[model samples]
Target chain A: MSGRSRSRQSSSVRISDEQITDLVHKLQQLLPEIRNRHSDKVSAAKVLQETCNYIRSLHREVDDLSERLSELLATSDTAQAAIIRSLLTQ
Target chain B: MANSKSAITLLNSTSSRLCFARTSATFASAPPDQLKRQSRRIKMAAYSSMARVAGRRRAWARALLFRLHTRPRHKTLMRRKRRPSTSSDDMVGKLRRLLPGGETMDVCTLLEETANYIHCLSTQVKVMKAISNHHLSKVN
Candidate 1:
């Protein structure tokens, strides 16, 4: 189990733009179902639940973006530091 | 005139000292509960003011983001208008000439833009959390 876990950790998965597009398309399709689910008989509790779910999803997106942003910032910072060090040394 | 001015200064200083003493005495004699309530009120006021400032900053950031988003579109429009007769190849040359520092500047600009976008996103997240908290507090 440890070896299998190590192998999985070693492999990095890259998500393609096409995959994102497909996921977006699937989400768009799912929207109507969500709308239909609460269309006719919308209760306050249901609306609140839906809103909470929506907010949670947004929070997740923000968290993901923040993580990516931090990674990019770190990479750029390191590169910039290396460049500055090299220039100073020279 | 000097005598009148000196008298005026003396009167002003005495009045100010009297007012300060009155205020301090009142504050010192106030009940503990009243003091606590006053402090709470002050704290609440400060918090609300901070929230208002944050909201204003978020609005400013959103406006900046809107400008950033539209800037490229505006640039393209201007490019089309300015060089209707120019070929695509010429456009590249023109852009290179227009942007003085070339690739390094472009990379720096891209990094700055990304940083601004991240700042905007983080501000939005903070605003969202505040809104959710406000809603929850209201419900409770």
Candidate 2:
């Protein structure tokens, strides 16, 4: 019985490890900067770092573009600008 | 007969006469000529609006496709100059700091959250680009 329980515990450990690797692989694919490189050379930790940096850059971009859009809308036709504003606020 | 001739002329002419006929038709009991013109204008308006909506949908899809194809302009260079600790624990600590609300998570949970965060950021980028393109196209 002890041997059987130990085997079960080890199987659960293996499963979690598999889950970690699977998620890491998904994160690697999502990152454009890392997707093109030698996949074997990148560690899981490296992928995480790249993802952090990429997300930061994307956030900055969203902020900048939103500011630009509002400035453009301020100058354009009010009717169309209002429509776009409603759509964006959603 | 004169009204019918005028109605035919209205149909052949441009939008100004169409508007004229519609306004005039609404105030009084419209003849078949005026009624035809009004119905035609209503149909055209609906059709044009539908086409505009479809065009916007196509433009958004194109924007997303363009995002997938183009690499981001800013490529960040990662520096290991800070800690240089080769331990996996040190790397995990740094990653936790990088991820939002990540300090309390275990390795598995952290990995899962990272994946979700990455997905959300990419979607945000796609949406921002679509909006910007829409406005620029309108202006130009």
lDDT of 2 by residue, B21-101 (tens): 234445444555554445444333222222232222232222233332352423221112355656755656766655544
Q: What is the overall TM-score of model 2 with all chains considered together?
A: 0.49
Winning model by DockQ:
2
Real contacts recovered, all predictions? 0.01, 0.35
TM for every model, in the order presented, reads 0.22, 0.49
Q: How far does residue A88 in candidate 2 sit from its true spot (Å)?
A: 10
Clash count list over all predictions: 0, 0
Chain A (alone) TM-scores for all candidate structures: 0.40, 0.68
* lDDT of predicted model 1: 0.34
Q: Which stretches of candidate 1 lie over 4 Å from their true place?
A: A1-38, A77-90, B1-140
lDDT of 1 by residue, B1-140 (tens): 85344333332332233223223333333555444333333222222322233333332233333333455532421123444535544422342322212222232232222233333333444433432233334334
What residue runs in model 2 are displaced by over 4 Å at the alpha carbon? A1-15, A81-90, B1-89
Instruction: List TM-scores of chain B, every candidate.
Output: 0.27, 0.36
Cα lDDT, model 2, residue B61? 24
